[model samples]
Target: MQHYTVIKDHISSYPDPIILRKEQEVLYGKEDTQFPNWIFCTSMATQKEGWVPKQILTTPNKQGIAMATKDYSAHELTANQGDLLLGLEHLNDWTYCKTENDEYGWIPTFCLSASN
Candidate 1:
């Protein structure tokens, strides 16, 4: 899978839209995106999956970035500026990513800077 970095803060995991709909059909016999313009993706590190806005995901022009836009606390990590991250997938403005510490979560797209 491709890699990315955490650019924004307060990124969290929701249900994968595709899987959510599939589960909805299985559990309640229905399928839905839950919200308009939402999409789905799976995490790379912990394999956590979730749904996000369609506008969050974007095609990266470079490898990744080296800093985080805000302080993030997850997976036993406190991600601050200069933390290395790998982009696993994109969902709208959110990017499913894994940190150098192997922590996984979603981050905003604008916070990343493609590695040179």
Candidate 2:
């Protein structure tokens, strides 16, 4: 008779959720008072959270901004310096983007946010 071994796995190692530290104080949503120390993924990354100021740069296109990723080149979109990327909608798909100049289009997700 042979004994069998089982391996259990869990998502504990998932990268700790990140929160945008604003003005040296962590901004919490109206409902986050309970988990004061925890970074809620929902509120941290969502449209309802409003636009968080981030330092982003231009992509290889040399035309727009770079939404960068950990691997490869960042997704490129049309955004110039000092441009205010408005609303949480702007954070959505890399494709079909509209900048402050009203230039609508697409880009890559790898295009890095300069703040990140």
Candidate 3:
């Protein structure tokens, strides 16, 4: 695990984030220009929407129907500035992290700084 300090406060945008199972279908939306490598997606079954890593999505056809390459959880962490966290996984400029309180979720990389 890697340590990080929250440089900027981040509030969870999605209280109920999207979840994708392997090979599950989704509707592809727009890509996030500010944060590259992430695209908006809505699960076909659950209809929950969130930003998912573009790499995890299969190429969409003309109808914007795509499949998930693997399981993905879009949960996000609500962290305050100066908080310490442990990042367990990193993908597409986001980090899967656990807060000091043991609450775990994803946080944007830009909000975190490497801790010594």
Candidate 4:
């Protein structure tokens, strides 16, 4: 099994239950699994609980921000340089995304580039 760092905080939903983590262990999806954009996985702590493990949907598109970009309000999310963001929606010069901490906001498209 491979492992992947949590580039962004993920809150699992039923029938997949897990928690936000800094890292997670990867698992194979079901033999009949059909989603091309998802990765089946479980957190190390969740595995210790002895409950049935769950799946994490892989983000289809991810990008790295070139520099820190701030939103208008202090309460809004800000993307620091080298931060990975999960692409949600793109509109002209901005892209709405979920930050590594699970905070959602729009960032300038110029600040983003394909993850290396």
Candidate 5:
């Protein structure tokens, strides 16, 4: 896995993120204008809502009901400039990363730089 240095500070904006199990059903809400292919959703089980990638959810019907394609966690990492992180997964415009302190969350690629 490649290492990355945070070029900019990123704070976790969404305090309560969406968590879903595979095949879990959800009710879709609004689409994120800033980030395409992502929509706000509330899990049918928990009723907790957060931004979710369209790639991870099945298409919703008229009633806005759909199923999660895979297990997902909308965790966000808070990192300061110059912090080192290990890249785990890259999706949409965000990368799931683990920090030196062992915290794991998704961070925007714009805030990170590849390190040799």
Candidate 6:
């Protein structure tokens, strides 16, 4: 199994969100017919110390990718360790975040470390 990481430290808001897509072809000879498998996601939520993660919207809406509704688009999704995050805006130290904004497209280079 492949290991993943959820950039929990970069979160900057609440109600995080993620999407999943099924694989059509087997990359390493793995046989599985699960449609809409796990892909990637983005949300916002302040951690224990006001750490917020940035929400990520898809670039071109991959296969089986479900788009969030306007009502629930602002909601934050839950993320745990090994969730696999790219990066967004900087908060301070050991923390960064991103989000799916109407104006700004996909920002995958924002990051903030934790303040020790």
Q: Which candidate's lDDT is highest?
A: 3
Clashing pairs in 5: none
Q: Model 1: per-residue lDDT, tens digit, 1-116? A: 55544344443343332222211211111112444454334433334444433333342224421121222222222355556677766555545677876767656656665553
Model 1: residue 22 alpha-carbon error in angstroms: 5.7
Best by TM-score: 5
| TM-score, predicted candidate 3 vs. hidden true structure | 0.91
Clashes of each: 13, 17, 0, 1, 0, 39
Q: Estimate TM-scores for all models.
A: 0.42, 0.21, 0.91, 0.34, 0.94, 0.21
- Cα lDDT tens digits, model 3, 2-114, are 99999999999999999999999999999999888899999999999999999999999899999999998999999999999999999888999988888889999999999
lDDT string for model 6 (1-116, tens) is 11124434333343332222232111111112331222233222211111112222222234423332322222233344444433433222222233222221121122222222
Model 5: residues >4 Å from true position, as ranges?
none
| Residue 18 displacement (Å), model 2 | 38
In candidate 5, what are the lDDT values of residues 1-116, reduced to their tens digit? 77999999999998888899999999988988887878899999999988888998888988999999999999899899999999998888889999888988899989999998
lDDT of 6 at 94: 25
Q: What is the lDDT of residue 95 in candidate 4?
A: 55
**Which sections of candidate 4 miss by over 4 Å?**
1-76
lDDT of 4 by residue, 1-116 (tens): 11122333333223333333333332323322432322333333444211112222232223310111121211223555567777676544445577767776555555667563
Residue 4 lDDT in candidate 2:
13
RMSD of 5: 1.0
Query: What's model 4's lDDT at 7?
Result: 37
Greater-TM-score candidate between 4 and 5: 5
Ordering by lDDT: 3, 5, 1, 4, 2, 6
lDDT of 2 by residue, 53-86 (tens): 2222112234322232221112234444344342
State the displacement of the C-alpha of residue 54, model 5, in Å, after optimal TM-score superposition.
Answer: 0.7
Instruction: Estimate the overall C-alpha local distance difference test score of candidate 3.
Output: 0.94
